[model samples]
Target: MKNCDFAYYLSNFFTTYLPGHLNVSENTVYSYRDTFTRLLTYFKDERSVPPDKLKFSHFSRDSVEDFLKWLENTSHCGISTRNQRLAAIKSFFRYVQVEQPEYLMLCQSIISIRSKKSPKPTIQYLTGEEMKLLLEQPDTADRNGRRDLALLSLLYDSAARVQEICDLTVRNLRLTSPPVVRLNGKGRKIREVPLSAPCADILRKYMQERKLDRQDRMDEPLFFNSQGRNLTRSGVSFILAKYISKANAVSPHSLPSTITPHCIRYSKAMHLLESGVNLIYIRDFLGHESIETTQIYAKANPEKKRAAISKTCDDSSAPKMPDWNDNPDLMSFLKGL
Candidate 1:
């Protein structure tokens, strides 16, 4: 049997295009791959079309629309997740449109499928006092506690994604004057975030105790498990939850109901915003692709909004109006009405 054009283009799109040409991160490629996997499974299970026999002709706009509905209604995916799956499919069709002009109309229809709108999520973050309580949970007397302290501090201070923290190495840390840690952000974008003196101090002690300060160990994972491997995203979350639970037990009313590594990131950005840091700087600090992404911190801060309003308000500038009682003509008019 002749090889299908869909298989031919799809293979090159993943192997050659996404990694080599687009230079997307491995995680992004994996996410895109998962979208297609689910899509193929949908055809196999729902439409009775086997994977090996499937072709481009089977993927009409209506079929793709039905698959998206299947994702939301049947698979129980949220609006955000369904939209993400649609985005991946649209991206694939976009690449196909450029490669083969013959399927231009079909590709356009699939690519033009609008994503479902979802409500914006409320940003969760910790206040300064609550953050202090959480950070103090780690007992620095033990070796593991010291490592946890350093990990939590750096995670909060850098406003880094969990994956970025996992990808960190001794070489990424610059402990000298003007201390900074180089973060490998999405799309392989490298951003050097300055370290706070307190965080740097903790890291210095942790590195010395672990003997990671030696010249021979630059490439070693900064934070690792007992098996001597870099921590996974789940590992980072688990570490955070452990500390949060301890903090909550001690002062249950003070801390937020739920917390994650990403919440630590949100807390960092919120603190910076409250300190009157510029949105542009926060965007760069948080490794956001756009300042718009960082604006959520500003929008979520009610205190900042009050402060801005208070600054612009002036009681002395108020204009006085003639009293209604003093105006007999207005009073008479009112009575007539």
Candidate 2:
């Protein structure tokens, strides 16, 4: 009815506060918008609170908790997804508290609700042999095959997110003495990742063939589909899946069934770590804000851990202690205790 209403504030929150004040990306804004859409849907279906009649007071701590539970139980969302929705709601309420201080207690209650703990996901990556098999799957003689080879090579070499690869323009490439590709990462952060000689060679040829090396075409996407548009995430995944299937057909265990573009990134990171690359450099390469995030690669690496353990001592020369159960004095002492 008035500008002070929940609908009014919600509208302004998306249109003004997120974009104007916070300067969040379009993707982020869309994600937040989706969360609110789901929230409204939950209210309508579960609580019988219609969209227009929904108020800020409807988002009480108990109601928010119930919605999260509904997401898991009824909606079949994972813990991470549930946490993400909660985070989005919390962010909105935080903005509301600043604008409408009268609802401070309610806002604080929702904010105080801790995120549910989710188990750390195992980082799936390709091994060197598996990577070799995958890279060889594409028929390099054909144009599309050459493109796929170049795409896979760059995907692994740059250790980029799928979105970063999608965002790549012709100008982002610099095939100089030390070739590098500029990756636009999350939070508007940019990082330059050095490409391997093979990767650079493939990219150089792909660009030359597509006329992307021309100054006029600098704004063009580095990789495109049959439609001459930049490859979407699903497009890239589809390409990978096709090759993965082929690779697996040849050697049944060459690649994992669940391999995605992200696995290529993880594979690259693992390869670098296995090669003794410093975590700091890996962090910068992967565009991670914290070294802790990069450390997951190191932690997940069992080979590195095994190598370290192997170097600690020679088992053959180590002194052996008597078995406690076989020693009469030790057994008597244990019985007394």
The TM-scores of all predictions, comma-separated, are 0.92, 0.92
lDDT of residue 258 for candidate 2:
98
Q: Write the per-residue lDDT of candidate 1 for residues 81-198, one digit (tens) a residue.
A: 9999999999889999999988899999999899988999999999898889999999999899999999999999999999999999999999887889999999899999999998
Candidate 1 runs further than 4 Å off: 1-3, 252-254, 314-337
Q: What is the lDDT for 199 in model 1?
A: 94
Shift in Å, residue 112, candidate 1: 0.5
Q: Write the per-residue lDDT of candidate 2 for residues 102-177, one digit (tens) a residue.
A: 9899999999999989899999999998999999999988999999999999999899999999999999999987
Q: How many steric overlaps are in each model, in order?
A: 0, 0
What is every candidate's alpha-carbon RMSD to the true fold? Answer: 4.2, 3.0
